[model samples]
Target: MNSPDSAAATATAFDKARTGLWVSLQKHLTTVYEAETAFAQAIAFAEAFPFAASSASPEQLDLYWQRRRALRDLFTDETNQLDTLNKAIRTKGYADAEKKQLYLLLLGYMDIAASIFERLHTEVPKPLPKDDELEETSARFERVRKFARLNVKGIFGLLATAAQ
Candidate 1:
């Protein structure tokens, strides 16, 4: 019963919605990638700090602590951003075909993130030497890595179902 012009307009609107979804997904993926990089840097710093033959000066210790804090903050911010993006997508609706495509793309990214996190968690070093500082750092890294893996899996499952 819709006129040709009206149908065309509807199609255009759907296209725009899909485009918006893609943009949002891309932004979230970028944030995730950045968070991953920050986490890797934090791990490297932590690993190097403990192995240095010379005693770490107070300044060096402070710098390592600062890096750890920064990485945590980055992860928090990225998580918040992902939540916002999910709300936006829900509000926008996903009944249209174009929107379904966007949902699939998001699912793909979520899968990738989950896989990366799992690999990192399994590969990361554990059981630090008797040093308390090294033990604490290793524990923190393990905790975050585990959290990331679990988070990614949950997100991926949700997105996959939503896309379907």
Candidate 2:
């Protein structure tokens, strides 16, 4: 159904894109973890100082906000790239519908990650959660990252199959 040359080219391009996405995602995750950690530390500081119990110290908030902004910017770049890639795939008619399904699955993973990052980066009028709650949020994020890793591997496998 598809030419070998076309498939090879698609595989190469997909590999390159996936690698970039992987690196960016890793950095994004690290940034998110750092932000959460900073917030948690702030919460701890607040608890120790009853006067600041209502909120974290200004320095801590600033650090968290900085990391959150970084995360938001990184995620925006990645999603933009993905949207472009999706459009390219459609234009090129890469492989078949089956291959497209793999891409869609990868998109789903991104959507879930977006939901997590959105909450972190949004300007909601809500106080940061307690340390214990923040740990749970971190756990959820880690789980999503792990699942995304698996999804990425699966997509690579699909590409391999298509290449052959």
Candidate 3:
């Protein structure tokens, strides 16, 4: 028979994970917002001047190079934070089922971000993303953020019952 001590410990572990995940979501969401804004602004700036894009090769343009560097830097930072968050949960002694669920949720969030960034990085220089596409990507990221915030709590509560 499972002991109440284990249940209590599980609850405590979940409480800590939930709190840390909340913080991570907040920070990651802020970075996502900033990166989206910065990338759009960079594209707009390049478009406004017109002549800045005057090159036989889009890669030769200064603004193009600048955006590439920016995306690379942002992606590097995000990867590091993602690694840290994964490590935190693994060492926390959560049940395997809960751990897998959390991992999948985190990956979903990361995929939304990576999609936006990758689309911008690839399409921004020459073709420029369609307004509809940009809107769709923004909407997708919003959905991911909202879902992550709401679902993580329920997951924690659900796992708490398993403790019993």
Alpha-carbon RMSD to native, per candidate: 8.5, 9.8, 9.3
lDDT of each: 0.52, 0.53, 0.61
State which candidate, 2 or 3, has the greater lDDT: 3
Ranking by TM-score: 3, 1, 2
lDDT of 2 by residue, 1-164 (tens): 87999778878876665565556656656665665455444344433322332365577667655655565455555455555545554465445543445455555556655565555434322544444534454555445444444445576776887799
Off by over 4 Å in 3: 45-52, 55-64, 124-164
Q: Which stretches of candidate 2 lie over 4 Å from their true place?
A: 1-54, 121-164
TM-score for every candidate vs. truth? Answer: 0.48, 0.45, 0.58
**Candidate maximizing lDDT:** 3
| Candidate 3 C-alpha RMSD relative to the actual structure | 9.3
Off by over 4 Å in 1: 45-64, 93-96, 113-164
Per-residue CA lDDT of model 3 for 49-93, tens digit only, reads: 233345435544555557645765666566566666666656767
Over 39-119, each residue of candidate 1 has an lDDT whose tens digit, in order, gives: 555455344323442344566545544554554454445445544544455466445344445545555655655544443
What 10-residue stretch in candidate 2 is worst by lDDT? 45-54
Model 3 TM-score (2 dp) = 0.58
In model 2, which residue pairs have backbone atoms overlapping below 3 Å?
none
Looking at model 3, residue 72 earns an lDDT score of 54
Q: By the TM-score metric, which is better: model 1 or model 2? A: 1
